[model samples]
Target: MASNAQRRDVTRERILKAAARLLSEEGPSAVTTRRVAHEAGLQPPALYRLFQDKDDLLDATAEHVFAGHLANKLTTAPSDDPVEDLRAGWNLQIGFGLANPYVFGLLLDPARARDTPGQAKGLLILAERVHRIAAAGRLRVSEERAINLIHSAGIGTVHTLLALPPERSDPHLADAAFEAIARAVLTDEPAAPAQDPAAVIASFRSLLPDLPNLTEAEAALLDEWLQR
Candidate 1:
């Protein structure tokens, strides 16, 4: 015998799957309560019990999309070159936005946007990649700045590409955007003062924690310079 809770769980999954399909095929405007319920073969009232409102439903559907994206991102093993790994992540994110425009649109809505486990995990993955670059003395900017620059540039690239017609889209914009950001955040050589003075400071900052004979406060002061 199926318990009520188990039945509800199954029903919820069915509803979300239908909603996702609707969003993907028909576009964001088609994902209404009536349409979702019809696609799910459930009463509209039943959806109310699961999702508070339309915005809630949209957010959940976006989460469903991100869940899969995050899983795919995790399965790809990291490469030896952290910079290359970061570029790979950028490609993955750009692909996701282009492939799932409906989900991307819903997530862009300020009223519908909120933090999700999937987004948190994605940020953590980005941060780790940036950290690796910094640790390797290849980063000319702070890890946080580099991460933010990559994230902002990626968002802008996706938005700009999506706004144009398919035939009108510039296929090379993504590559160009990444290269521009790389120039701003990275150096050609690793930790060479002549090549990049800030990179040397950043490289030295990597050793701040391990330097012996420093008091806790002194170490704190030097670590603050890493932000530059």
Candidate 2:
């Protein structure tokens, strides 16, 4: 027999699955306590035991649906080329959003994003990718700026594609958008030449903490000079 904790886990999974179905098929407004309980074969009061309220239930449902996508993202091994790896991640992100627009919208909603743990994890993954590029002396911008640009561009690409009438949709928009962001944030060549010394400085700044024999204040001052 299932233990009490095991039974609760099973019950939670059933509720989340039902809620996710309603969200995907009928949208957020349809995921009420009554409807979800019916769909999950439980009474309305059962959900209260597992979740605080309707909003809490909705947040958990979103997290449940995104779990698989996040796992897939985690499985991508880093390649020899960081640029190629980033582009792969970008393509995967766009594909995931296009394939799961309902989940994407729920995750994107600022109001509903009140309890988003997945987004934070995804940002950490992106930061690691950007850090790799900076360490390679290929990024001409700060890591924060580069991460923001890539993240914004991806979100915009998904929104653009989804907003289009099917006949007007251009599949190449994602590739073009990524290339534009790349051009804005990355140098034409690695360890950018004298004409673009910022990339080199950015590269050094990435290793600031690893440099030997530098006091905290001295490192901070050097970083300020490098940013200039």
List per-prediction Cα lDDT, in the order shown. 0.87, 0.90
Error of 2 at 32 (Å): 2.2
Instruction: Compose the digit string of candidate 1's lDDT tens values, residues 3-88.
Output: 99999999989999999999999987888999999999999999999999887888998998888899999999988998999899
Model 2 residue runs over 4 Å out of place are 1-3, 192-195, 215-218
Model 2's TM-score against the true structure: 0.90
In model 2, the worst 10-residue window by lDDT is 187-196
Give the residue spans of candidate 1 off by over 4 A: 1-6, 193-195, 204-221
Could you tell me which residue pairs clash in candidate 1? none
Candidate 1 to truth, TM: 0.87
